[model samples]
Target: MQRRRLGREWCWIVRGGQSGGAATPAPTEKVIGMSFPAADHGWLGAVIKNAEDEAKAEGLKYVITTAADPNKQTNDIEDLISKKVSAIVMLPIESAAMTPVAKKVKEAGIPLIVVDRELESDDFTALVKGDNTGIGTHAGKYLVDKLGGKGKIVEIIGVPSSVTTMRSDGFREAIKDHPDMQVIVSQSGDFQKEKSLNVMQNILQSQPQIDAVYTHDDEMALGVLQAIKEAKRTDIKVVTGAGGHKDVYKLIKDGDPLMQATFTYSPLMVKDAVKLAADIVGGKTPAEKVTMLEATPITKDNIDKFYDPNANY
Candidate 1:
């Protein structure tokens, strides 16, 4: 057995030999590839960090790539294929556009494990992600309770992706019971801080009396906060998702009047996906094709539990 260290974990790889006595040993080198969308935001940065940590612990050679454009991502995958890695872990930029790329990976005979986002085909061997709908629903319920089931709220959404749709749908479902809690204006922020700030500014101008705002991501939340301050609107409360950042935890911990709560959508899911890929190559079968990580709401009462100063995210 040959030993390799991955992050904090140790992995053992068994080598095979010929039937004859004193046969040559199998090679000890093994490599895995990981590809994801560029870290344009805080959550994705966390994902990259966690994946690197896991790769180091498992003692597997790792290759990482990121692309802001779908076409670029497709090309990156092709490059990885040429390298003939043992397996691939991908977080697609666009599910539909990346399906063909997934097929190409499968055709190469490399085990494919997708994280966070999914392609159109089921050809992938495994997937690891959080419940986006659940995160949205939690945010909606929290807003309703804070506003006593009646208030004018606005929503700053992420990019137009399947994950965004699921989060939006769940939020609408949770608030359906509160007829008075209406969403006055909703718009796409493209999941960027500056874009969210500009969109939020326009929304404030159009609707002068918003009681609350729900931005799906913490990066957007920060932009929304700045927009609120610039407008001098103290009436509006905020709820966001992705609780890994230090700023978000601090706001909730101190009971910031504007930022009331956030939902946990850990980037550690990437780490889990990498480990699963290693296991598949090492000959361990997982119990399920899809693994769903829980999404928990982080409120002022329990914010202390997740506040880790040492956390990279």
Candidate 2:
């Protein structure tokens, strides 16, 4: 495999032509191509690692690419199409930005296995991801119960994608019945801990009495916790997060009042996506066009079930 640095992104060329669109490769020369957004947080970092590890473990020829933005990811997918890989597995940076290229992948006759985020159109062969709306619903219900069905909530959202839209929509839907529950401040943390920390700090200064926080990702939740602790704020009773990070589980296990729960959105789902691509290459058709994984809630009551000391994310 040859690794090349293309500006901010990285592209690994295992075996393929340097230019031109996808072509029909011989059976023995077939390669599975993977394109993902660059690791912006621990969860995404684990996703990238799992995808690469799974592709290698399957004993399949593959090309992997990572991009920091939608435009860069678009280029990565185009390059993969040119490589003429047998199948393409992509975890899009943003839904709309990648949908057009996803259509192109389908036009080139390459089986596409979408992971995590969904494209605008159903162009992919298979999609493997955790239940995004379920995560938000679970988180909202938990916070509602914890705060006695009424609270001023602060929401730290992810980027502009289907994941963000669905999660936010589901959370609002869950809290809609309880008119007392209100979102005092909702801002994009962009799913990064440091960015979340900065955003949480500003929110903390602005909002004097926040009853709870509903963060879209666990890393962002951790950042929110840090901000709350630094400011010594006591009004915020609970902080709920999505994406099961081990650090958040530790807090729940230790009975931290603020760090109560997180929804299960494991990065290991990418492993399934890679395996699906390899399966498609091996002349197997997916049983379902979309594979939705469960998003189980993890709290202190069930912390033992998910608290893995050896886990990566």
For each of the candidates, give the backbone clash count. 8, 0
- What TM-score does candidate 1 get on C-alpha atoms? 0.88
CA lDDT, every model vs. true structure: 0.79, 0.87
Worst 10 contiguous positions by lDDT, candidate 2: 14-23
Choose the strongest candidate by TM-score.
2
- How does model 2 score by TM-score? 0.92
What's the true lDDT of residue 20 in model 1?
16
lDDT of 1 by residue, 198-309 (tens): 9989988888788988888888888888888999987786656454577878877888888878888788899899999889879888779999888788888888899887
Predicted model with the maximum lDDT: 2
> Which parts of model 2 have CA positions greater than 4 angstroms off?
1-28
